[model samples]
Target: MADTQTMPVALVTGAGRGIGRSVASRLSAAGYRVALTARSVEDLAGTAAECPGETLVLPGDITDPAFVDQLYADIEAAWGAVSVLVANAGAGVSASVVRTTDEEWQRMLDLNLTAPFRCLRRALPAMVERRHGRVVVIASVAAKIGEPYISAYTASKHGVLGLVRSAAAEVATKGVTVNAVCPGYVDTPMTDATVRGIVEKTGRSEQEARSALASKQPIGRLITRDEVADAVLLCVTNGAITGQGINVDGGAVPS
Candidate 1:
């Protein structure tokens, strides 16, 4: 058996809830000393409580470059350089290209694309030096295809997917692997918000709106948080799975 103190260290961003929380718990169960981060201290505390193994909770806004730098520094100070990074914190906004305000467009790019890029930049050098690391970005099916009223969100996800592919290629010679997990309409608070928006805009009942979203997946259900976490763990453990976006979308956007 391996020493608990020598367990691999994993840092999961946006870990307060949803897929991030599930990923953190899953990694902890897999014997990783997981570090959890998000903007909400209460939420991070809740996630840390659910983790079965050791956890370090750090709360902050990952979109801020300074915070991203400090986040990596703090994690390194606590548990050396992270051997696994799950960049799962992101937000989506629905608007037609014409209706999307500059602020909203930038928000999507900042939180979903640029923030992950910053985290990757900060984490990759140490990982390359160690020649042992895994990076999984929690992207969306939006990254793989175009959809109405979500142009900005799609653009951001697509950009992050490109980032993952490029980074994976750059570090393939090293022992590091970079991948993205693309989930579709996950049953999380984020999807709850999307359902609420549909109800408000289309006058659909809550159940009807939810079913409509679920029907988008051929499986007729929103993807589960645990399912997405499973994909992340696969990327973490499989050295040959680099530069791939494993879809947990129930066959929604088959590529």
Candidate 2:
């Protein structure tokens, strides 16, 4: 674990909004000096303003390997080292397996799976050398269960889980722990997009579309962004917790 006395540096991808923004806020409140990253620096401003401690707003596309390298370089230059990494940036698409195009598959995989891989690849060496680090991947319930019309998203999320588990095993004895938080039907801009899609496709009211997603969970309501961030904080603070996919789906996949 990182030193509790000194403020740790937390790098959060997609810190622009939603769960990522919530995670950044939570970590900042917990005494972390957060480094926020997204496409445009302006996207991270809201999160940065909410942070209690220091913040670095980095703008870049993680799918580009060069950007991934440069992101770490800038963080290292500014904060020296990052003690925690929240791989939260992702993209989603709704399309049946037969209708999913190759471009869609690649885009989803590149941002959702490969980008996290790139971040971890850069992060592990420093963490391993220091013998202290926390890793949390913001995956989804889709990783554990299959849903129609989102084969690419499901596959990418599944890969995220695999990456978390395998990376945790590799660093198990090295003092770094990796874990994943799987959220179900989160109430966010992304959920709104899903709702809009449902409304367009099925001619359902927005409320009906929302309820359709909520009904999948046993709790019959959408999970909040902060709820998922809380789960990530559990892994971040507890050394005993590692290689686990903590679900915030209200029993939606029950994994």
Candidate 3:
């Protein structure tokens, strides 16, 4: 068994809650030294508390390039180059193509696409040089199939998946692996927010809104956070699974 000093280091963005929090805790329990970052200090602390292994809490906006750069530097200064990176920081905006404003479109792109791109770029050099790394971005089923009222979110997710595929190919010869975990509507706070939107727009009861989302999945239920984390773990352990978008969407989009 690897000692604490020799355990791999993992950095998880948007580690405050939802899938990010679950992934961070899962990595920690898997014997990784995790670094948690999000906009909320309290939430980061909450995630850190659940981690049985060592943890570093770094709270900041990943959409800011400066913050992304500094977090990598701080991680290196503390635990060394990141052996695993989960770019799970992202936001979804519900809007039609015509109704989507410039600000909303840009925000989706910045958080979902650009932020992951920046993190992937920063992590590659050290990983390639050391010839060891794993990168998994938490994307969505919207990336594969388009649905109504989410033009910006779908586009951004599509872009991130593309980024993952291209980056994985570039680092394939090296020991580093890059992949994306595309899940359907997960039972998370983010999904709760989406339900609220449905309530406001369609006058559907909160339960109805949630059930509608669940019905979209052929499994007739929402995907759990742990399920998504399992996919990330698969990517980390299997070196041959790079450049693929592993769907945890309960057979929603058959590939």
Candidate 4:
């Protein structure tokens, strides 16, 4: 539980846009000093400008271990310790196993799995010492179900859930909670690209392509970025959400 007198600091990766941006903004509104990290300096700066409290833009490739170490070092030097870490920097690369190259497979695993692991490892020691921390990994619905042409993306997300579950169990008694949020078809740049891919394949209008994807979900439309952000906020602020993967997929996934 957070003390009312001491405002917590949150480090959000991929905070440039979409759900990550919304989560970072929401945390700031809730009185957390935010440290925004992304590969794009301009986009991170834009997000920082919208935040309510002190915001630091730390732009670097999260997949690079050296860059990750430097990121934590900078945070430790400036803020002493971070109270929250949102591992939201991930991407989807679609290709069947037979067509997937080793580079593609490794890239997905590096960004989606290993990067989060690195961030968690760096933050755990400080959080354990303080007896307070919230670690949220933003995974995807593909983790639970089979998605065609996206084997690497699915595998990486599944690995994310495994990491969250194992780490949460280890840190539960130490006042740190680790959790994963799985969102489906959120209206983001990622979805836009997916829609474009559909359009190219079917020669359909963008709206039609988007609709085709959205119709697969039980809900009639794609989930909004803010909706996903809300789920992350719940995980970060609640003490009892450890070792869980809360799905915000508009009921796309069955319980």
Error of 4 at 174 (Å): 0.7
Prediction 2 TM-score vs. true: 0.97
Local accuracy of candidate 4 as per-residue lDDT tens digits, 140-202: 887788878999999999999999999999999999999999998999998999888888877
In angstroms, what RMSD does candidate 1 have relative to the true structure? 1.0
Task: Give the alpha carbon lDDT tens digit for every residue of 143-248 in model 2.
Answer: 8999889999999999999999999999999999999999999999899999999999999999999999999889999999999999999999999889998889
Arrange candidates by TM-score, highest first: which order? Answer: 3, 1, 2, 4
- Output the lDDT of residue 200, model 4: 85
lDDT of candidate 2 at residue 149, scale 0 to 100: 96
* TM-score of candidate 4 to 2 decimals: 0.96
| Candidate 3: regions farther than 4 A off | none
Q: Write the per-residue lDDT of candidate 3 for residues 41-142, one digit (tens) a residue.
A: 999999999999899999999999999999999999999889999999988999889999999999999999999999999999999999999999999988
Q: Score every model by TM-score.
A: 0.98, 0.97, 0.98, 0.96
- The residue-level lDDT of candidate 2 at 61 comes to 90
Instruction: Report lDDT per candidate.
Output: 0.93, 0.93, 0.94, 0.91
| Candidate 2 lDDT for residue 57 | 92
Model 1: how far residue 61 lies from native, Å: 0.6
Quote the positional error of residue 10 for candidate 1 in Å. 0.5
Task: Go through the candidates in order and give the clash count of each.
Answer: 0, 0, 0, 0
Point to the candidate with the largest lDDT.
3
Lowest-sum lDDT 10-residue window in model 1: 1-10
